[model samples]
Target chain A: MNAVIFNGPRKIDVEKRPKPTLRDPTDAIVKVTSAGICGSELHMYRGHQKTATGHIMGHEFVGFIEEVGSDVRSFQVGQKVVCTFSPVCMCCWFCEHGYSNRCPEGLAPFGTQGLAGGQAEYVRVPFADGTLKSTPEGVDDELLIMMCDIFPTGHYGAMRAIECFRSSDLVNGNHYTDLDSPKRSGLSKSQSLEEAVFVCLGCGPVGLCAILTARSKGVRTIYVVDSVDDRLDQAAKLGGIPLKLGRDDVQAKVMKATQGRGADAVIEVVGNNAALRSAFDLLRPCGVLSSIGFHQGDLPFTALECYQKNLNINLGRAPVRTVFDEAMEVVAANKEKLASMVTHRLPLSKAAYGYEIFEKQLARKVILVP
Target chain B: MNAVIFNGPRKIDVEKRPKPTLRDPTDAIVKVTSAGICGSELHMYRGHQKTATGHIMGHEFVGFIEEVGSDVRSFQVGQKVVCTFSPVCMCCWFCEHGYSNRCPEGLAPFGTQGLAGGQAEYVRVPFADGTLKSTPEGVDDELLIMMCDIFPTGHYGAMRAIECFRSSDLVNGNHYTDLDSPKRSGLSKSQSLEEAVFVCLGCGPVGLCAILTARSKGVRTIYVVDSVDDRLDQAAKLGGIPLKLGRDDVQAKVMKATQGRGADAVIEVVGNNAALRSAFDLLRPCGVLSSIGFHQGDLPFTALECYQKNLNINLGRAPVRTVFDEAMEVVAANKEKLASMVTHRLPLSKAAYGYEIFEKQLARKVILVP
Candidate 1:
């Protein structure tokens, strides 16, 4: 089986690796049809995150189940499915409590440790019943692939920001939409959602998805900040008000847009100190900052800064398995946008090119067909 | 009027200061009958917080409305009322949005800036209708005074933790209490609240109030951490499982008590990096950390730590005015316990002694009669 292997820093190689087989009864072998070269992968490609040599390099993929272990009751061979970035045990306290992202028994992001990833032609998916979700009928492979990771993550960040705001005293006098009822999901009786201003820092794939998610959830104004002009243009195409970093006065634009109140919510997808600082500065009192970035640095703001701003910070990896269904609904709702999100599609042999374009931020999203 | 003035570090003096008079159309001059030395005041007393010489030293008080300005329609002269620690302008965006604690127009804690402290014979309260709540007819001045800051602060910490938990997917399958309705505010349909474990760092006034508040809200097990045995004993008396820092293996105890799940929630009232570090180490994945402490230090945890733990942190000053009515109900329900909370009562002339005992953790709470 041919696979994209992590050789070293800024190194990639297409090599013939042994085909994966089910290690546990709950495991299944997924023949990867389509996989994404994520922005997170850039962290490893750029040597930001340590990666072992010969490790498979993708966590987002959509394909058919080539084989299923006897214990895998929910899926069968030939079933079309999407795999979550990390596998969950499904019965751990965190998994039972709907926080599968932190499942103590198993939350290893695929392609790391002993778990090989989906960039290969065949990959073993442990806890298949918990990790794999069937693609909705009629959805394209690329659109369903988006639901595998970044889309759900972006959706979760946006959803969490809105949820935090909805449960706050900020919405006390204002009529707001209830997310539980799909028929009445967005702004309805009140224009508060339309009036509420949001900010998304970074215009990467996940940030673009956050913008789309915010729009679908009835947020009328989203000030998207990014350094790259191409990414900012993509955000603007998705209806986000783009603020180019170091070029535009980001804080002034957000404050002006929000009537000097700052943003009601900020979805921070850029996992750096500067982005976190901007998030703190661009939020109003009692504002929610939902950070979905895979940050490695210490928090930029002091405890006093958080208190004075009365900040509510909800941050973590998206529980992809938990929010899969809802994210699919969002994906289904914005199928066209998701389709356009894929800027480049390449064969498994062209994985190096995919990595290069993605690392340079020249491509919005690159899909590799195996 | 005689008042407790901040002279210098560890130097408190009872001095004759001019009696405060109504200064604005919404101001009211209160004849302070009782004022309590709070944990927050100790910060300024110890010079941790900058305090000007001759600054009056208390923010918690129960008094009679001696005089009301023309715009103070809700508060009448001679009405018994409890004044919030900080006065909030009723018309600010934060005040209208339910975050009166961060009211940009007027969140200066009384005793700071131009606002005279309440530890005097008379104190002027701006936004009288917004800051003062009428005391329950039969409640003791001391118990109602508790509602001014610490009690509501503790209650807010507990409530915010519970609210954050309730609105999460953790309570999806489990039946939980609804906070809006007084009748259904605690555990009812399920025993999850009883099974849930909470941790409170620091067993001073606010931490003690947190224990009582958690118990009142049907949280059966709370591990209260403190270095002082006296404070731990007070927490034990209020149904908390006391954990003495340095004396006990705090992390081991919490892990054992929670089946290695850490704490379901952590109410951090100690305004230091150590307490914040303890909070991060003691919380389970997706646990809520409600910090009502006035911390000046940078956050102890890194963004990676927060992300890895999937933490939800709600930190700020308690909006005493916003939660005034609810806290009064908590106060009314636990009046007997609250009565025992005030371990020392001193005359205005003995303010120095009161500050000494309270600063040394010899007193659970100190009330000064003016």
Candidate 2:
């Protein structure tokens, strides 16, 4: 099997590696169908996070199960499936609570698992019964590929921001939102959910997904912030109002749009220091702030701003499996229109060029077929 | 009327201020019955917070309705009442949402309203109808003083922690939880809850109140942490297992008590960086970490640990109105014994001395009488 391996910083090579096999009883060997280059992969490529040499790098993949171990009962050979970045055993406490990504006995579904990735011809899925989910009959690799993580990550980020927004005592009376409250705006009957705007930082695919997610749920005004003009244009094409980052007074512009209320919810999808800080500055009193941006280093923040604003500061990984179904429904609803997001698609042999274009932010989402 | 005022750091002096008359049409003048010297007073006394010289220095008080402006209609003159520190207008956007504290048109009961402290002969309360609560027939100053903040802070902390604990997916079968579920040794369901230990960091009145509040809910194995031995001893007398800060390994102790599973919920009453960090450290995977502590400064936390441990981080100011009823209920249930938390009593004439003791963290609840 030919796999993309990370040798060191700024290094990538396509080399022949042994095809993966089902080593554990709960494991399933998946033949690569389609995979997408991820933002996290760039971290490894940049040496932000240490990745070992000769490691099979990708985790975002959709595939057909080519072989199943003896104990694998939920899947069979040749079944089409999508799995998340992390694999969890369904029996683990975390999995039972809908956090399949944090299963104690789970394995990282990438090169770290000592198995070749879907970037190759085959990959082994640990805890297949719990981690792998079959796509609906008509969903293709192009659509189902999102089930792996991106769509859910974006959806979870938006949902968490909504959670924080609903928590504003200024908006909902008190910050103690009943997890039992309807997942959207946990407003009591007395509290009205009238007009609100969401400002999404970063014009990546995830940010676009968030714009779609927020708009689908009734928000008419959506602001997308990004430095790159082309990316901003892409966001605009995807039904978002784009604003140039750093060049524009995003805080004042958003505040003006919200009638001096600031943004009702600020989602920082870009993990830069300025983006995180701006996320807080762009919020209204009791505004919701959530981020899915992965930062490599520490940044300064103010609890006073968080408290005086009476914010419900929530931080955690995106609950992928929890939001996967809703995300699929969303994509399915906007299928033909959102298809433009996949600007470039190439065979696995051209993976190197796909990654190069993505790094320069020249291509939005580069899908590689196997 | 004479009141304790903050002139400078450690320079508190009694000011012969003019008697407060009704300024707002909705205001009520209360003949201060009993005022409690609070830890928050230190925020002003040490110049940590902005305080006007000759300004009244207290927010915690129980009093009687001596007079009311023309628009006041809720209570009659001569009625005993407990004033809430955070006032709600009942009609404001935040008030309607149940966050009377952040009421857009509301005012803070003390320094916020540009008045002298409640540590005086009389205090004026604006938005009187919603801010002042009449004492239930026989409730004395000892009970009434609590409604101002600390008791409700504890109850809010307890309820918030409960909500976080229940919502967290840190169980054996949950993905993030089971990965590090403290039950490295197989423990049954009966053992887990039976061995549930609760830890309250900082045995200040607020911390003690949280210990009492959680205990009031029948939580087993309560541990109280404080740097002062006297406070810890008081906590022990209040039925808590006391652990001296820095002197004791609170996390290890709680883990041992729960058979290596950290406390089910760790309520942080002291908002200092050390206590806040310890509170996070003291929790087992899926543990609920709530801070009611008035963290005066910034406390940077490691996000990866919080995510990897699957911590449910909840930080907020006391939602006074939301849990006022529960606090009263909890207090009423254990009234006979819990009132012992009030450690000292001093007349309003000695308000300066009272502030001195409170600044030193020497008193639990020092009640001031006219």
Candidate topping DockQ? 1
| Pairs that collide, model 1 | none
Q: Comparing to the true complex, what docking class would candidate 2 get?
A: acceptable
Best by TM-score: 1
Question: DockQ of every model listed?
Answer: 0.43, 0.25
Runs of candidate 1 with Cα error greater than 4 angstroms are: A170-192, B170-192
TM-score of every candidate relative to the true structure: 0.93, 0.86
**Interface RMSD, all models, one decimal each?**
6.0, 6.7
**Candidate 1 overall Cα lDDT vs. reference?**
0.82
Judging by lDDT against the true structure, name the best candidate.
1
Per-residue lDDT for B1-370 in model 2, tens only?
A: 8777667778767778889899999989999978887776676677777755656778888888999988888888998888887666666655555555566544454743265568788888878887888777666788778888998887777666654454343222221212122222222122232346678887888777777777765566778888898788878876789887678876778878866656778888876677777787788665667787766566556544544555556566775764566578777776776677787888777877877787776776788887
Number of backbone collisions per candidate: 0, 22
Q: Write the per-residue lDDT of candidate 2 for residues A1-86, one digit (tens) a residue.
A: 88877778777777888887768999999888888888767767777777567787787899889999899998988888997777
lDDT of 2: 0.70
User: In order, what are the TM-scores of chain A for the candidates?
Assistant: 0.92, 0.90
**In candidate 1 chain A, what residue range of length 10 has the lowest lDDT sum?**
A182-191
